[model samples]
Target: MKKITTPLKEKDIRALKAGEEVLLKGVIYTARDQAHKRLCDLIKKRRQLPFALKNQIIYYCGPTPAPPGKIIGSCGPTTSSRMDKFTIPLLKNGLKGMIGKGKRSAEIISAIKKYKAIYFLAPAGAGAYLSKFVKKKELISWPELGTEAIFRLEVEDFPLIVGIDIKGRSIYDKR
Candidate 1:
Protein backbone atom coordinates (compact mmCIF):
# COMPACT_ATOMS: atom_id res chain seq x y z
CA MET A 1 0.00 0.00 0.00
CA LYS A 2 1.02 3.59 -0.66
CA LYS A 3 0.11 6.88 0.98
CA ILE A 4 -0.85 9.82 -1.24
CA THR A 5 -0.74 13.16 0.56
CA THR A 6 -2.08 16.48 -0.61
CA PRO A 7 -0.51 18.72 -3.20
CA LEU A 8 -0.43 15.28 -4.71
CA LYS A 9 2.87 14.55 -6.40
CA GLU A 10 3.09 12.60 -9.64
CA LYS A 11 6.05 10.59 -8.35
CA ASP A 12 3.90 9.16 -5.55
CA ILE A 13 1.20 8.22 -8.02
CA ARG A 14 3.59 6.75 -10.53
CA ALA A 15 5.30 4.66 -7.87
CA LEU A 16 2.00 3.03 -6.91
CA LYS A 17 1.75 -0.56 -8.06
CA ALA A 18 -1.39 -2.22 -9.25
CA GLY A 19 -3.60 -3.47 -6.39
CA GLU A 20 -2.00 -1.09 -3.92
CA GLU A 21 -4.26 0.80 -1.54
CA VAL A 22 -3.76 4.52 -0.99
CA LEU A 23 -5.11 7.20 1.30
CA LEU A 24 -5.39 10.63 -0.31
CA LYS A 25 -5.46 14.03 1.37
CA GLY A 26 -5.88 17.54 -0.05
CA VAL A 27 -8.24 19.51 -2.26
CA ILE A 28 -10.10 18.03 -5.20
CA TYR A 29 -12.36 19.57 -7.82
CA THR A 30 -15.89 18.39 -8.62
CA ALA A 31 -17.39 18.16 -12.09
CA ARG A 32 -20.33 16.22 -13.44
CA ASP A 33 -21.50 15.46 -16.98
CA GLN A 34 -22.73 18.91 -17.97
CA ALA A 35 -19.73 20.63 -16.53
CA HIS A 36 -17.47 18.19 -18.29
CA LYS A 37 -19.09 18.96 -21.63
CA ARG A 38 -18.64 22.66 -21.12
CA LEU A 39 -15.05 22.10 -20.07
CA CYS A 40 -14.40 20.18 -23.24
CA ASP A 41 -15.93 22.93 -25.31
CA LEU A 42 -13.74 25.46 -23.55
CA ILE A 43 -10.70 23.35 -24.20
CA LYS A 44 -11.61 22.99 -27.85
CA LYS A 45 -11.89 26.74 -28.32
CA ARG A 46 -8.80 27.31 -26.14
CA ARG A 47 -10.77 29.27 -23.59
CA GLN A 48 -9.71 29.58 -19.98
CA LEU A 49 -11.30 27.28 -17.43
CA PRO A 50 -12.37 28.32 -13.97
CA PHE A 51 -9.49 26.48 -12.35
CA ALA A 52 -5.99 25.62 -13.42
CA LEU A 53 -5.48 21.98 -14.40
CA LYS A 54 -1.88 21.51 -13.41
CA ASN A 55 -1.21 18.95 -10.65
CA GLN A 56 -4.89 18.91 -9.69
CA ILE A 57 -7.42 16.24 -8.87
CA ILE A 58 -10.90 16.11 -10.37
CA TYR A 59 -13.63 14.18 -8.59
CA TYR A 60 -16.56 12.96 -10.64
CA CYS A 61 -19.61 13.66 -8.54
CA GLY A 62 -22.70 15.83 -8.02
CA PRO A 63 -23.25 16.01 -4.31
CA THR A 64 -26.48 16.77 -2.49
CA PRO A 65 -26.91 20.29 -1.11
CA ALA A 66 -25.59 20.92 2.34
CA PRO A 67 -27.87 21.45 5.30
CA PRO A 68 -27.54 24.40 7.66
CA GLY A 69 -24.16 24.93 9.32
CA LYS A 70 -22.54 22.37 7.07
CA ILE A 71 -19.61 22.80 4.75
CA ILE A 72 -20.99 20.40 2.20
CA GLY A 73 -23.83 17.95 1.75
CA SER A 74 -23.79 14.22 1.08
CA CYS A 75 -20.54 13.84 -0.83
CA GLY A 76 -19.76 10.57 -2.51
CA PRO A 77 -18.11 9.14 -5.56
CA THR A 78 -20.21 8.99 -8.68
CA THR A 79 -19.80 6.38 -11.36
CA SER A 80 -16.66 7.13 -13.34
CA SER A 81 -17.56 5.55 -16.66
CA ARG A 82 -19.68 8.55 -17.57
CA MET A 83 -16.64 10.79 -17.64
CA ASP A 84 -14.57 8.49 -19.84
CA LYS A 85 -15.08 10.37 -23.06
CA PHE A 86 -13.84 13.61 -21.56
CA THR A 87 -10.87 12.06 -19.78
CA ILE A 88 -8.40 11.99 -22.65
CA PRO A 89 -8.79 15.60 -23.73
CA LEU A 90 -8.74 16.84 -20.16
CA LEU A 91 -5.62 14.80 -19.43
CA LYS A 92 -3.94 16.33 -22.41
CA ASN A 93 -4.54 19.73 -20.88
CA GLY A 94 -2.70 18.79 -17.64
CA LEU A 95 -5.28 16.92 -15.56
CA LYS A 96 -3.19 14.51 -13.52
CA GLY A 97 -5.67 12.80 -11.28
CA MET A 98 -9.29 11.65 -10.96
CA ILE A 99 -11.46 10.34 -8.13
CA GLY A 100 -14.66 8.45 -8.56
CA LYS A 101 -16.38 5.08 -8.28
CA GLY A 102 -16.53 2.15 -10.70
CA LYS A 103 -14.65 1.35 -13.88
CA ARG A 104 -13.77 3.64 -16.76
CA SER A 105 -13.69 2.90 -20.45
CA ALA A 106 -10.76 1.53 -22.44
CA GLU A 107 -10.03 4.90 -23.98
CA ILE A 108 -9.79 6.53 -20.60
CA ILE A 109 -7.43 3.86 -19.36
CA SER A 110 -5.36 4.42 -22.43
CA ALA A 111 -5.29 8.12 -21.78
CA ILE A 112 -4.20 7.60 -18.22
CA LYS A 113 -1.20 5.64 -19.41
CA LYS A 114 -0.41 8.23 -22.04
CA TYR A 115 -0.76 11.14 -19.67
CA LYS A 116 0.99 9.52 -16.70
CA ALA A 117 -2.08 10.16 -14.56
CA ILE A 118 -3.83 8.24 -11.83
CA TYR A 119 -7.40 7.44 -10.81
CA PHE A 120 -8.55 6.91 -7.26
CA LEU A 121 -11.77 5.38 -5.98
CA ALA A 122 -13.69 6.78 -3.07
CA PRO A 123 -16.04 4.58 -1.09
CA ALA A 124 -19.35 4.11 -2.81
CA GLY A 125 -22.72 4.59 -1.08
CA ALA A 126 -21.15 6.55 1.74
CA GLY A 127 -22.10 10.09 0.93
CA ALA A 128 -22.83 11.37 4.40
CA TYR A 129 -19.67 9.91 5.83
CA LEU A 130 -17.60 11.43 3.05
CA SER A 131 -19.15 14.83 3.53
CA LYS A 132 -17.35 15.17 6.81
CA PHE A 133 -14.01 15.40 5.02
CA VAL A 134 -15.02 18.38 2.92
CA LYS A 135 -14.17 21.67 4.61
CA LYS A 136 -15.55 24.03 1.99
CA LYS A 137 -17.00 24.13 -1.52
CA GLU A 138 -16.75 26.82 -4.17
CA LEU A 139 -18.77 26.76 -7.36
CA ILE A 140 -16.20 27.26 -10.10
CA SER A 141 -18.15 27.12 -13.33
CA TRP A 142 -21.27 26.11 -15.24
CA PRO A 143 -23.62 27.26 -12.51
CA GLU A 144 -26.48 27.04 -14.96
CA LEU A 145 -25.90 23.30 -15.08
CA GLY A 146 -27.53 22.98 -11.67
CA THR A 147 -26.11 20.05 -9.68
CA GLU A 148 -23.89 19.33 -12.65
CA ALA A 149 -21.98 22.53 -12.01
CA ILE A 150 -18.23 22.37 -11.41
CA PHE A 151 -17.14 22.90 -7.83
CA ARG A 152 -13.74 23.37 -6.30
CA LEU A 153 -13.79 21.42 -3.04
CA GLU A 154 -11.40 21.99 -0.21
CA VAL A 155 -10.84 18.74 1.64
CA GLU A 156 -8.52 17.35 4.27
CA ASP A 157 -7.45 13.76 4.73
CA PHE A 158 -9.87 12.58 2.09
CA PRO A 159 -9.88 8.78 2.06
CA LEU A 160 -9.21 7.00 -1.19
CA ILE A 161 -7.93 3.78 -2.80
CA VAL A 162 -5.76 3.61 -5.86
CA GLY A 163 -8.04 2.36 -8.58
CA ILE A 164 -6.01 2.82 -11.75
CA ASP A 165 -2.42 3.81 -12.42
CA ILE A 166 -0.57 5.46 -15.26
CA LYS A 167 0.58 2.08 -16.60
CA GLY A 168 -2.96 1.09 -17.56
CA ARG A 169 -3.27 -1.15 -14.52
CA SER A 170 -6.42 -1.33 -12.39
CA ILE A 171 -7.13 -2.65 -8.92
CA TYR A 172 -10.76 -3.55 -9.54
CA ASP A 173 -9.98 -5.69 -12.54
CA LYS A 174 -7.40 -7.66 -10.60
CA ARG A 175 -9.98 -8.50 -7.97
Candidate 2:
Protein backbone atom coordinates (compact mmCIF):
# COMPACT_ATOMS: atom_id res chain seq x y z
CA MET A 1 0.00 0.00 0.00
CA LYS A 2 1.17 3.53 -0.72
CA LYS A 3 1.60 5.46 2.51
CA ILE A 4 0.42 9.04 2.61
CA THR A 5 0.19 11.83 5.16
CA THR A 6 -2.67 14.24 5.77
CA PRO A 7 -2.83 17.94 4.88
CA LEU A 8 -1.70 16.74 1.51
CA LYS A 9 0.22 19.05 -0.78
CA GLU A 10 -1.00 19.63 -4.29
CA LYS A 11 1.86 17.56 -5.67
CA ASP A 12 0.98 14.72 -3.33
CA ILE A 13 -2.63 14.80 -4.46
CA ARG A 14 -1.57 14.90 -8.07
CA ALA A 15 0.45 11.73 -7.56
CA LEU A 16 -2.60 9.65 -6.63
CA LYS A 17 -4.46 7.56 -9.19
CA ALA A 18 -7.83 5.82 -9.10
CA GLY A 19 -7.90 2.28 -7.66
CA GLU A 20 -4.63 2.61 -5.78
CA GLU A 21 -4.55 1.31 -2.23
CA VAL A 22 -3.31 3.78 0.34
CA LEU A 23 -2.61 3.94 4.03
CA LEU A 24 -3.37 7.43 5.26
CA LYS A 25 -1.78 8.74 8.43
CA GLY A 26 -2.16 12.06 10.19
CA VAL A 27 -5.09 14.35 10.95
CA ILE A 28 -8.34 14.23 9.06
CA TYR A 29 -11.69 15.83 9.75
CA THR A 30 -15.10 14.15 9.90
CA ALA A 31 -18.40 15.49 8.64
CA ARG A 32 -21.61 13.96 7.41
CA ASP A 33 -24.66 15.40 5.64
CA GLN A 34 -25.88 17.84 8.28
CA ALA A 35 -22.42 19.17 8.97
CA HIS A 36 -21.79 19.51 5.26
CA LYS A 37 -24.96 21.54 4.83
CA ARG A 38 -23.90 23.86 7.61
CA LEU A 39 -20.50 24.31 6.02
CA CYS A 40 -22.08 25.12 2.67
CA ASP A 41 -24.38 27.61 4.30
CA LEU A 42 -21.39 29.33 5.84
CA ILE A 43 -19.71 29.46 2.47
CA LYS A 44 -22.79 30.83 0.75
CA LYS A 45 -23.10 33.54 3.34
CA ARG A 46 -19.42 34.47 2.83
CA ARG A 47 -18.72 33.66 6.45
CA GLN A 48 -15.55 32.03 7.64
CA LEU A 49 -15.54 28.25 7.92
CA PRO A 50 -14.83 26.57 11.23
CA PHE A 51 -11.71 25.04 9.72
CA ALA A 52 -9.45 25.85 6.85
CA LEU A 53 -10.07 23.74 3.74
CA LYS A 54 -6.81 24.02 1.92
CA ASN A 55 -4.88 20.77 1.63
CA GLN A 56 -7.36 18.98 3.87
CA ILE A 57 -9.30 15.75 3.70
CA ILE A 58 -12.86 15.41 4.95
CA TYR A 59 -14.04 11.95 5.95
CA TYR A 60 -17.75 11.32 5.53
CA CYS A 61 -18.53 9.52 8.76
CA GLY A 62 -20.72 9.90 11.83
CA PRO A 63 -18.97 7.81 14.44
CA THR A 64 -20.88 6.16 17.24
CA PRO A 65 -20.14 7.14 20.81
CA ALA A 66 -16.94 5.62 22.04
CA PRO A 67 -17.08 2.66 24.35
CA PRO A 68 -15.28 2.83 27.65
CA GLY A 69 -11.49 2.87 27.18
CA LYS A 70 -11.73 3.55 23.44
CA ILE A 71 -10.75 6.66 21.53
CA ILE A 72 -13.66 6.40 19.15
CA GLY A 73 -16.40 3.96 18.14
CA SER A 74 -17.58 2.34 14.95
CA CYS A 75 -16.26 4.86 12.44
CA GLY A 76 -16.91 4.20 8.76
CA PRO A 77 -17.61 5.90 5.51
CA THR A 78 -21.06 7.23 4.70
CA THR A 79 -22.66 7.31 1.25
CA SER A 80 -20.84 10.18 -0.48
CA SER A 81 -23.63 11.14 -2.86
CA ARG A 82 -25.66 12.57 -0.01
CA MET A 83 -23.10 15.34 0.32
CA ASP A 84 -22.62 16.00 -3.40
CA LYS A 85 -24.57 19.25 -3.33
CA PHE A 86 -21.99 20.75 -0.99
CA THR A 87 -18.89 19.22 -2.56
CA ILE A 88 -18.07 21.58 -5.38
CA PRO A 89 -18.13 24.57 -3.11
CA LEU A 90 -15.84 22.83 -0.66
CA LEU A 91 -13.47 21.87 -3.46
CA LYS A 92 -13.38 25.38 -4.77
CA ASN A 93 -12.46 26.50 -1.28
CA GLY A 94 -9.28 24.39 -1.58
CA LEU A 95 -10.39 21.06 -0.15
CA LYS A 96 -8.04 18.44 -1.58
CA GLY A 97 -9.48 15.09 -0.67
CA MET A 98 -12.63 13.27 0.46
CA ILE A 99 -13.05 9.89 2.13
CA GLY A 100 -16.30 8.01 1.76
CA LYS A 101 -17.90 5.03 0.06
CA GLY A 102 -19.74 4.29 -3.22
CA LYS A 103 -20.04 6.10 -6.50
CA ARG A 104 -20.17 9.88 -6.83
CA SER A 105 -22.21 11.96 -9.27
CA ALA A 106 -20.92 13.31 -12.56
CA GLU A 107 -20.99 16.83 -11.24
CA ILE A 108 -18.87 15.85 -8.27
CA ILE A 109 -16.43 13.98 -10.46
CA SER A 110 -16.14 16.99 -12.69
CA ALA A 111 -15.50 19.25 -9.76
CA ILE A 112 -12.86 16.92 -8.39
CA LYS A 113 -10.96 17.20 -11.65
CA LYS A 114 -11.44 20.90 -11.97
CA TYR A 115 -10.20 21.41 -8.46
CA LYS A 116 -7.41 18.81 -8.70
CA ALA A 117 -8.81 16.78 -5.85
CA ILE A 118 -9.17 13.10 -5.09
CA TYR A 119 -11.83 10.88 -3.51
CA PHE A 120 -11.07 7.86 -1.37
CA LEU A 121 -13.22 4.94 -0.26
CA ALA A 122 -12.99 3.20 3.07
CA PRO A 123 -14.25 -0.32 3.45
CA ALA A 124 -18.02 -0.49 3.86
CA GLY A 125 -19.56 -2.21 6.93
CA ALA A 126 -16.17 -2.20 8.63
CA GLY A 127 -16.80 0.52 11.15
CA ALA A 128 -15.69 -1.43 14.16
CA TYR A 129 -12.47 -2.38 12.46
CA LEU A 130 -11.88 1.12 11.14
CA SER A 131 -12.21 2.72 14.55
CA LYS A 132 -8.97 1.06 15.51
CA PHE A 133 -7.13 3.52 13.30
CA VAL A 134 -8.46 6.58 15.05
CA LYS A 135 -5.84 7.42 17.66
CA LYS A 136 -7.56 10.57 18.88
CA LYS A 137 -10.84 12.41 18.29
CA GLU A 138 -12.16 15.79 19.24
CA LEU A 139 -15.46 17.47 18.49
CA ILE A 140 -14.74 20.49 16.34
CA SER A 141 -18.07 22.06 15.44
CA TRP A 142 -21.88 21.82 15.39
CA PRO A 143 -22.38 20.03 18.70
CA GLU A 144 -26.14 20.10 18.14
CA LEU A 145 -25.75 17.65 15.30
CA GLY A 146 -24.74 14.82 17.67
CA THR A 147 -22.98 12.05 15.77
CA GLU A 148 -23.17 14.20 12.67
CA ALA A 149 -21.10 16.88 14.36
CA ILE A 150 -17.79 17.72 12.70
CA PHE A 151 -14.70 16.34 14.41
CA ARG A 152 -10.95 16.51 14.16
CA LEU A 153 -9.37 13.07 14.16
CA GLU A 154 -5.84 11.80 14.34
CA VAL A 155 -5.44 8.52 12.54
CA GLU A 156 -2.65 6.09 11.72
CA ASP A 157 -2.52 3.87 8.69
CA PHE A 158 -6.19 4.29 7.86
CA PRO A 159 -6.66 2.14 4.79
CA LEU A 160 -8.52 3.36 1.74
CA ILE A 161 -8.64 3.05 -2.02
CA VAL A 162 -8.57 5.93 -4.42
CA GLY A 163 -12.15 5.99 -5.69
CA ILE A 164 -11.66 8.95 -7.99
CA ASP A 165 -8.46 10.71 -8.98
CA ILE A 166 -7.71 14.28 -9.94
CA LYS A 167 -7.86 13.15 -13.52
CA GLY A 168 -11.55 12.25 -13.08
CA ARG A 169 -10.86 8.53 -13.36
CA SER A 170 -13.10 6.56 -10.99
CA ILE A 171 -12.78 3.09 -9.55
CA TYR A 172 -16.50 2.55 -10.10
CA ASP A 173 -16.00 2.63 -13.84
CA LYS A 174 -16.70 -0.83 -15.29
CA ARG A 175 -13.71 -2.36 -16.97
Candidate 3:
Protein backbone atom coordinates (compact mmCIF):
# COMPACT_ATOMS: atom_id res chain seq x y z
CA MET A 1 0.00 0.00 0.00
CA LYS A 2 1.19 3.48 -0.75
CA LYS A 3 1.50 5.95 2.13
CA ILE A 4 0.28 9.47 1.44
CA THR A 5 -0.28 12.76 3.28
CA THR A 6 -2.88 15.52 3.18
CA PRO A 7 -3.41 18.40 0.73
CA LEU A 8 -2.76 15.69 -1.84
CA LYS A 9 -0.33 16.58 -4.57
CA GLU A 10 -0.98 15.99 -8.27
CA LYS A 11 1.90 13.54 -8.56
CA ASP A 12 0.52 11.48 -5.68
CA ILE A 13 -3.01 11.57 -7.06
CA ARG A 14 -1.84 10.62 -10.56
CA ALA A 15 0.22 7.67 -9.32
CA LEU A 16 -2.80 6.09 -7.63
CA LYS A 17 -5.00 3.66 -9.51
CA ALA A 18 -8.46 2.38 -8.83
CA GLY A 19 -8.41 -0.59 -6.45
CA GLU A 20 -5.05 0.34 -4.97
CA GLU A 21 -4.64 0.22 -1.20
CA VAL A 22 -3.44 3.30 0.65
CA LEU A 23 -2.49 4.51 4.11
CA LEU A 24 -3.45 8.16 4.39
CA LYS A 25 -1.90 10.45 6.98
CA GLY A 26 -2.00 14.13 7.89
CA VAL A 27 -5.07 16.34 8.08
CA ILE A 28 -8.49 15.71 6.52
CA TYR A 29 -11.60 17.78 6.92
CA THR A 30 -14.94 16.18 7.80
CA ALA A 31 -18.09 17.46 6.14
CA ARG A 32 -21.42 15.71 6.17
CA ASP A 33 -24.53 16.50 4.08
CA GLN A 34 -25.36 19.71 5.89
CA ALA A 35 -21.79 20.94 5.73
CA HIS A 36 -21.68 20.13 2.04
CA LYS A 37 -24.81 22.14 1.36
CA ARG A 38 -23.42 25.07 3.28
CA LEU A 39 -20.18 24.91 1.36
CA CYS A 40 -21.93 24.68 -1.98
CA ASP A 41 -24.14 27.62 -1.05
CA LEU A 42 -21.08 29.67 -0.23
CA ILE A 43 -19.57 28.75 -3.56
CA LYS A 44 -22.74 29.87 -5.32
CA LYS A 45 -22.60 33.29 -3.71
CA ARG A 46 -18.88 33.56 -4.41
CA ARG A 47 -18.30 34.02 -0.71
CA GLN A 48 -15.24 33.00 1.23
CA LEU A 49 -15.39 29.48 2.66
CA PRO A 50 -14.52 28.53 6.20
CA PHE A 51 -11.52 26.80 4.69
CA ALA A 52 -9.88 26.81 1.32
CA LEU A 53 -10.56 23.89 -1.02
CA LYS A 54 -7.27 23.94 -2.88
CA ASN A 55 -5.59 20.55 -2.89
CA GLN A 56 -7.72 19.54 0.09
CA ILE A 57 -9.40 16.26 0.89
CA ILE A 58 -12.84 16.22 2.40
CA TYR A 59 -14.02 13.08 4.17
CA TYR A 60 -17.74 12.41 4.03
CA CYS A 61 -18.41 11.71 7.66
CA GLY A 62 -20.19 13.01 10.73
CA PRO A 63 -18.29 11.73 13.74
CA THR A 64 -20.02 10.89 16.97
CA PRO A 65 -18.96 12.72 20.12
CA ALA A 66 -15.75 11.64 21.76
CA PRO A 67 -16.16 9.55 24.86
CA PRO A 68 -13.99 9.71 28.00
CA GLY A 69 -10.46 10.12 26.60
CA LYS A 70 -10.53 9.58 22.85
CA ILE A 71 -9.75 12.16 20.16
CA ILE A 72 -12.86 11.16 18.24
CA GLY A 73 -15.64 8.55 18.16
CA SER A 74 -17.22 6.31 15.55
CA CYS A 75 -15.61 8.28 12.75
CA GLY A 76 -16.74 6.25 9.75
CA PRO A 77 -17.28 7.30 6.16
CA THR A 78 -20.69 8.27 4.89
CA THR A 79 -22.11 7.37 1.46
CA SER A 80 -20.36 9.42 -1.22
CA SER A 81 -23.23 9.64 -3.68
CA ARG A 82 -25.28 11.87 -1.40
CA MET A 83 -22.78 14.64 -2.01
CA ASP A 84 -22.72 14.16 -5.79
CA LYS A 85 -24.68 17.30 -6.48
CA PHE A 86 -22.38 19.41 -4.35
CA THR A 87 -19.18 17.76 -5.52
CA ILE A 88 -18.52 19.34 -8.91
CA PRO A 89 -18.75 22.82 -7.50
CA LEU A 90 -16.07 22.02 -4.95
CA LEU A 91 -13.98 20.32 -7.59
CA LYS A 92 -14.36 23.38 -9.77
CA ASN A 93 -13.13 25.38 -6.82
CA GLY A 94 -9.96 23.21 -6.46
CA LEU A 95 -10.92 20.37 -4.13
CA LYS A 96 -8.58 17.51 -4.97
CA GLY A 97 -9.67 14.39 -3.13
CA MET A 98 -12.43 12.75 -1.11
CA ILE A 99 -12.82 9.84 1.32
CA GLY A 100 -16.11 8.09 1.75
CA LYS A 101 -18.03 4.83 1.26
CA GLY A 102 -19.80 3.40 -1.82
CA LYS A 103 -19.93 4.34 -5.49
CA ARG A 104 -20.18 7.67 -7.23
CA SER A 105 -22.33 8.65 -10.20
CA ALA A 106 -21.02 8.49 -13.77
CA GLU A 107 -21.03 12.26 -13.99
CA ILE A 108 -18.93 12.39 -10.86
CA ILE A 109 -16.52 9.91 -12.35
CA SER A 110 -16.29 12.05 -15.47
CA ALA A 111 -15.76 15.10 -13.36
CA ILE A 112 -13.07 13.37 -11.34
CA LYS A 113 -11.20 12.70 -14.56
CA LYS A 114 -11.73 16.20 -15.85
CA TYR A 115 -10.61 17.78 -12.63
CA LYS A 116 -7.74 15.36 -11.97
CA ALA A 117 -9.07 14.31 -8.58
CA ILE A 118 -9.44 10.98 -6.77
CA TYR A 119 -11.96 9.28 -4.50
CA PHE A 120 -11.06 6.94 -1.64
CA LEU A 121 -13.19 4.33 0.08
CA ALA A 122 -12.87 3.81 3.80
CA PRO A 123 -13.89 0.61 5.59
CA ALA A 124 -17.57 0.26 6.23
CA GLY A 125 -18.83 -0.91 9.63
CA ALA A 126 -15.43 0.02 11.03
CA GLY A 127 -16.24 3.29 12.72
CA ALA A 128 -15.06 2.35 16.16
CA TYR A 129 -11.98 0.70 14.74
CA LEU A 130 -11.17 3.74 12.59
CA SER A 131 -11.35 6.10 15.54
CA LYS A 132 -8.06 4.65 16.65
CA PHE A 133 -6.27 6.46 13.80
CA VAL A 134 -7.52 9.95 14.54
CA LYS A 135 -4.79 11.71 16.52
CA LYS A 136 -6.57 15.03 17.00
CA LYS A 137 -9.84 16.79 16.24
CA GLU A 138 -10.74 20.46 16.15
CA LEU A 139 -14.09 21.98 15.36
CA ILE A 140 -13.93 23.93 12.08
CA SER A 141 -17.42 25.34 11.65
CA TRP A 142 -21.17 25.05 12.27
CA PRO A 143 -20.91 23.53 15.73
CA GLU A 144 -24.61 24.11 16.21
CA LEU A 145 -25.15 21.50 13.52
CA GLY A 146 -23.54 19.07 15.96
CA THR A 147 -22.24 15.86 14.39
CA GLU A 148 -22.79 17.27 10.91
CA ALA A 149 -20.50 20.19 11.66
CA ILE A 150 -17.19 20.46 9.86
CA PHE A 151 -14.16 19.17 11.77
CA ARG A 152 -10.48 19.05 11.03
CA LEU A 153 -8.81 15.80 12.02
CA GLU A 154 -5.19 14.86 12.15
CA VAL A 155 -4.70 11.21 11.24
CA GLU A 156 -1.90 8.70 10.98
CA ASP A 157 -1.80 5.73 8.66
CA PHE A 158 -5.55 5.58 8.19
CA PRO A 159 -6.40 2.77 5.79
CA LEU A 160 -8.31 3.32 2.56
CA ILE A 161 -8.79 2.06 -1.00
CA VAL A 162 -8.89 4.05 -4.19
CA GLY A 163 -12.51 3.80 -5.20
CA ILE A 164 -12.08 6.12 -8.17
CA ASP A 165 -8.83 7.24 -9.70
CA ILE A 166 -7.98 10.36 -11.63
CA LYS A 167 -8.47 8.50 -14.90
CA GLY A 168 -12.13 7.90 -14.12
CA ARG A 169 -11.50 4.28 -13.21
CA SER A 170 -13.76 2.94 -10.49
CA ILE A 171 -13.76 -0.27 -8.44
CA TYR A 172 -17.55 -0.26 -8.73
CA ASP A 173 -17.22 -0.39 -12.51
CA LYS A 174 -16.10 -3.99 -12.20
CA ARG A 175 -19.58 -5.13 -11.27
Q: How displaced is residue 11 in candidate 1, in Å?
A: 0.9
Which candidate tops lDDT? 3
* Alpha-carbon TM-score of each model against the true structure: 0.93, 0.98, 0.99
lDDT of 1 by residue, 2-91 (tens): 457655677887788655666666778899788888889999999998888987899998999888899888889899998888888899
Ranking by TM-score: 3, 2, 1
List residue ranges in candidate 2 displaced over 4 A.
none
Using lDDT, rank the candidates from best to worst.
3, 2, 1
Report lDDT (CA) for all predictions: 0.84, 0.94, 0.95
The residue pairs found clashing in candidate 1 are: none
Runs in model 3 with CA error above 4 Å?
A: none
Cα displacement (angstroms), candidate 3, residue 59, comes to 0.4
| TM-score of decoy 2 | 0.98
Error of 1 at 141 (Å): 1.5
